[model samples]
Target: MKRKLRSGITASLLAVTACMALHSPQSLAARDAQTILKETCQGCHTPEADNALSRISHQRKTPEGWLMSIARMQTMHGLQISDDDRRTLVKYLADTQGLAPSETDGVRYALERRLNTVEKFDDQTSQMCGRCHSGARVALQRRPAQEWERLVNFHLGQWPSLEYQALSRDRDWFDLARKEMVPLLAKRYPLDNPAWKKWQASAPKAQAFVGDWNFSGHLPGKGELAGVMSVTADGDDTFKVSVKGQYADGSPFNGDGSAILYTGYEWRGNVTIDGVTMRQVFAAQGSAMQGRMFEAEHDERGLDFVAAKQGSSRLLAVQPGYLKAGTETEVTLIGSGLSGKPNFGKGVEVLEVVEQSPDRIKLKLKAAANAQPGLRSVMVGSLKGPTLSVYSTIAEVKVVPAFSVARIGDGGGSTPKVQGRFDAEAWGKGADGKLYRIGVFPAQWKVEPFDDRAREDEDVKFAGTMQADSGVFTPGDAGPNPERKMSTNNAGNLKVIAAVDDSGKSLTGEGQMIVTVQRWNNPPIP
Candidate 1:
């Protein structure tokens, strides 16, 4: 079955309000994690022997997981809590009872809204739970066997259709869930892991991000970018962030937004640049931070952002980071503490230094026509970091995402249309006989029918429009189309194709896109 990346939550999920002073300074300060927990949760959650509350005490989760829990409380348990109090509870629970950084390493895709990720899991877990939601969703939490069993019960009790689903109907779903899944989940992700204990005892304070930072990223439609971000403390775990930089084309990239640090390292920021609102989901560790930042509304359009604090002298990236083996071009090295002589490895010659700075170094360079095609390490002074590709010919062009999903909406409705973004990644075989990724290159985009059914149904004409130069696929409007047979909604299977011209040679890559209906169940996690 084709996997649809973008899904939605129902309107019934919890609503978290914007961050602001909803109460007096004294009142807010008085309502710490413990105080709010006692007043809000003590009614339903029984106190344990060690002063821990039931259910919540036995599990560890990310900030989003906790938020979902509170949202569920409001929807299913008649728990009426203010937005301010809910936010406080989420922070407190996440910080004190959250997963360790190591625990969240591989699952950051779910948090970053890289919704296109194809999940892999053991058969029992995948078929039993992940068939409906993400396996990452289950892997994100650490729970005891008892809690896992309780969760299984909750699933069957809440959604009584559990036994009627395709895979579930073939067997004793409840027996397998309790007997097989409970033990598997418990052993795989135990509540008493040592990483959690260590993290809880030594996690850094939220103020760690109060300083200047060097950042670099790439947005699909908008070229490469590098800049500096300044952060300041706003409230308890909240921050005020400002970014100043420019795209590779010298276009200014400036914005300011508020941020909230959850579980010490999770950095969530909302900034607006040139009137476009963007959100940052980064992990801060000491002086370095990295993550993806996307437009809050249209998440498909985003940048893979990486940043280092101002103090580090590490080389971050090379803007316009590629050069044709026989061509001369100007490229900027964006980093910290760039000095001394500059080098671009073997085949590249530094003709002149266009600009130099402590944070940036611009140089005019040329690659020999006989340059061995591969990624060349860039160096500035003694510090060695960052790499740019040198290739004479495009060996192959592969669409970045081999498969994805786009939604049909914005036809006078609450849910907006989800666009399908694509990038053409060029690769070359080096002298050592390894396929090295050159980088994202310009391409002409088009769509065709995926199968004979799609062709017979005229899906290409009715599904959507693919931008030629930008590779942006915007799906058609929602509701039934009178022109299509049966007047069906504008949903169809499409073959996304990209044509690239390297020098004079043409290369093409193809991917799959499912333009489908609206998903009303969008939530913070999914």
Candidate 2:
């Protein structure tokens, strides 16, 4: 029975490729996705004699998701494939068996790489699904009850000590998951869906959507961007794209590149933003588009990209959109439309309108002493600007990264330091009898040992020192001295402490910093 099932599955995959070959004959002849899959994936995925390719056949995922699976296989099963072949397989699988647009709606924030965006999950779901991995990971899949059951078994079979892990050991995890979580998952995300049915029925032509697209974006701590992207058909599945724009600082931001629109709506492109190579992950649904443009080398340093079929109007972005509570500063607002008097929301007041134009506006503003430490809406006539973040009283101080790992060996000179930032949050008891976040506030800096063992570590004294003004840590040279354990490098773990004593309130927070060995391959990606 299992042999028959595996044979049928292999035939189904081949049949799907055969249908695609009728339209993309060149694709089949050159780097055929299905050909790569048959050669590399069928061994373990397919049956020997009585085993089925159940897991492989029954699921779908994104291109990056498939790449992760391939990477996992290489790590665990020693699966080997050339880079070219890997790319071919990933592209093919994603094109033929990827999630529908509606299916990915819940996890779009994860794909867009938004920071600190929390996923909503019920108490049971949080405990059962979100405890080990992110909610997005769980939301990205569709499985039947039996498949979900097999997945639980696969977890136990692969990692026998799973139940003994800290989070899993709190209760009878296996029993609860079997009786409760499994049913919930099966009901919420079943294998069959109307969205997938519609998507698989017909493939949309990318040429129909090719045109000049107007876009706007913003990267926190960087600046805002407004641009135009001209897209033309390159092939049946590919496009040639060019972009031109400017940052808020007036620096030229432009690029020319190509893209592949897979899964109908996933527009994956390689382009340059502000002279830096970046990858564009856009979801094109009808005339509207939204996604991200991130450094291809390092996914961090990216911006939120949103575009529309029509020209931008009344869209405003305020640069450095925040002020120290009760302090005064100049604020710049950029957009395509402007008029009459401006309204600087509550807790803030405009002292003077420094400048005004259709595309720009500048104002000197002062924040009230009792200003709210959170985002506030900014409005000018009917045009709404990007919400501004305000900081005043610091009820709590926290090192941005709760913990970090920095390496030794800086190749002489003054030796590089890790520039850490501190954040003050308005933490207080709410009327609902719970502690809720009020937002970011202001703070000061210091350092100490994280624990008793850290206290004994001489690295705090001899290894490095933290700047009082800036939270940056300057480590001493790598060594083979008699100070540390085994006379190794000046490596140790310490705590970064941030303090805030403002407006008659005192608060403090600490984070762990691990100073360790040298990193040889400091690649651009890292």
Candidate 3:
């Protein structure tokens, strides 16, 4: 009776185990595959503890094959198992876990879901091909069946772990995968397309100039004269001019020049020549031809000319103090004798020339009552092909000053000096509310180069500093920390401080900064 009771308990326990196995969740069963392999077959095949069952699951074979593999494992690998228990486990695996027809269907369904279409390549082939190479690399090439076979053999040799050696055992499945991939790749990324054609078409065109221009013309022996002129245009009818030039000779012709023009049926432009000022006009002739030119103040000795073109590219007449705005009407005036001339005391001369539709001319002059009023005040003018002619009474012109400033010191020096130099003598207002002269000893200071080159010579060490009129200097932040104040280390070795005008006040501001320089060492000979 005691033995019978013990047998009953044993039978009950077996029934419970079977019930648990059948009722377990899919996730639990998946985990059980790993757990069973670990607990039962991990002794001799220690490295295969976790991977053994995974390898088996990826292989789809008949029930008999599964049993045979397990039998081999037991005999060859010394996995100890009773015949009855082994038979029961084999039956359980074959019935509940063997590859079913649904397994292939599920794999196909997953591949379709991931790729969004039916593909020539199976999921396994897609993964293997994409691992070390791009899909386009294979798709772009067309190959015969033999070529593809050779390609596969080459890959098998390159990456032996892909286990192409086992292909014989799974020849049918591998062949199916390969055949699917080849055609799918070929269709998606074809070799011929319009994008390639477009790229081939556009590769060469020159660029236009859109910046400042510096030009100069000088007389022979007398002090050399230089002039600066800038040209800019608006939509189709307006143009602006700023002319600043100087003569080395001490004459009445030296002074600042300026003009403004508007275009319509006729065009109008104003100009100041040597110390003489005048206005002129033009009418459009089918093609828009409008621009202005001024012979250098000392051009009487020789033809030193400066011309700017806009609206049209036609070359107008060449004459001293000639101003043309449009295409038809031209005005002539006299610069001297303003004292005897009506409204001449104001040093401005007005001349009425033939009026063409849309063209207007006006003149202005500034002179002293005691000044000599004769041929020096009269301006003679005429028109030639595209060029307006003007005769100036004043022959010699004075020089206009051009000045530039530079800073020199240690990158972070407490006291910084600005050295200024002028082509000619210059007297100008400084930010300090004091009058300053360029090139003179008292007004302009000479700066010597600093000796910080040892540390500041690096590309990263160069930097500049800025200061405000309030005497406060704020250094900017550097690096990723946007809110932190800029540091010396964060700045480059070299520094420059410049006086910048902001909000009507002259302030010191930081200029460009350099950080550290990167150098590469040569590689050793192999």
Candidate 4:
């Protein structure tokens, strides 16, 4: 059997809430890991005669990893433990058995919840392993060949329908995994590495981040933002963080939050930015940090964030971030200690420095008709700034939130339709054969069914309408609609298309959007 009950329970768990508070403050007093596991988990996670736990003892993971595992046990296997006990057990396992810092470097992106991260794997591994989940999930582990082989067996045994899935149906998945994959994975990720040994011998007693840092990031559709952050230790591994920054438009933005570091490197924070709550997932390594920041409510909207130790002079951000070929555009450079005439990297010409300050510089910058396109470094005197992108003819236009979801508004005197926004950007191929961004541009917006089946079902007409000038979709109200399949809510899978005029040519790009039902109990970490 495929363990349908577990699958349904997991779906419910994930769909409903990302964080579960199952214990009161009084119940969270520290307890021995052995006692808690024996009382709540031993019924299924039976200990061997050696007094060692079965699968739990063999595996090592970050606190978040252990939390997910325990949550699965609670939901699927009927394990029961107070919230305090669960927290205590997770800490015990992570502190004693977590991967070293170096071991976590590759998969930190996964833990940080960064969007659009590409996982690298060889062709064999990609087909054999990544066909189901991320390759980073594989890279995050260390095991012997025998153990890897057994894990493959576990997958097949737990989900007997694996062999019938699209990726495995036509291939000898079981045989190849047993023979080729086991050895490849074992050799690739041996348990003992020299770096880990060195780190363990001299690892600092505490590696809490407690200082001011400078940060810069790009928010898709919102342009570039630069800021300074102050972090102070709030607990052994928790922090209080404050941020002060501005968007490219010079609008002041400020945020305050708290964070908890799990496994020493993973920093997860809940904060409010620009009057809206947001979550931050960043990794700290020595004097540098980088990660993703997104809305606490809707994770689909996120951006890249990076920071370096404070007190250094560097370029932090470039407003608009890109220049259209042969067009004169005003650019703002946000940074610290900026001086002298700025160099606009290659293929860019500065007409005049409009204004100057230690932290802000505005200039009229232009790219020649034949200028090279792509991200180029910015420099002013000894201070280096963020990158600027340039592009010529609009080779393409892509709508962001490529795959989007929106829910209809509740009909109890509320607006009849929920609005979803979209932004379109133009892009051009650079000399290096890579696509260079041309930034957002005004475009004609339209919506259509994602496929022929959706088109025949008239989804675009019943589900929503795309506001041509603004690129926003207003979805129909929620209810059982007899027009839709199964008489469900007015939901749809749609393609948002953007068309822009470049010189005399018209270019178009499309992205996926889905209008669905409302989500209850949306959690910050989901």
For this target, which candidate reaches the highest lDDT against the unseen true structure? 1
RMSD to the hidden true structure, all candidates: 3.7, 9.0, 35.0, 5.2
Of candidate 3, the 10-residue stretch with the lowest lDDT total is 517-526
Best candidate, TM-score: 1
lDDT values for all models: 0.83, 0.66, 0.31, 0.71
Cα TM-score per model: 0.94, 0.64, 0.15, 0.77
lDDT for model 1 comes to 0.83
In candidate 1, what are the lDDT values of residues 394-465, reduced to their tens digit?
788898688989999987877789999989999888888888888899899999999999999999998899
Q: Is candidate 1 or candidate 4 better by lDDT?
A: 1
**Number of residue pairs clashing in candidate 2, backbone atoms closer than 3 angstroms, sequence gap of 3 or more or interchain:** 1
Residue pairs in clash, model 2: 424-441
**Residues 123-168, candidate 2, lDDT per residue (tens digit)?**
8888777766667776777778898898888778877888988768
Clash count of each predicted structure: 6, 1, 45, 2
Alpha-carbon shift of residue 259 in model 2 (angstroms): 4.2
Residue lDDT tens for model 4, 213-271 = 77778765455688788888776766788999887678876988877665555567777
> What's the C-alpha lDDT at position 131 in model 3?
47
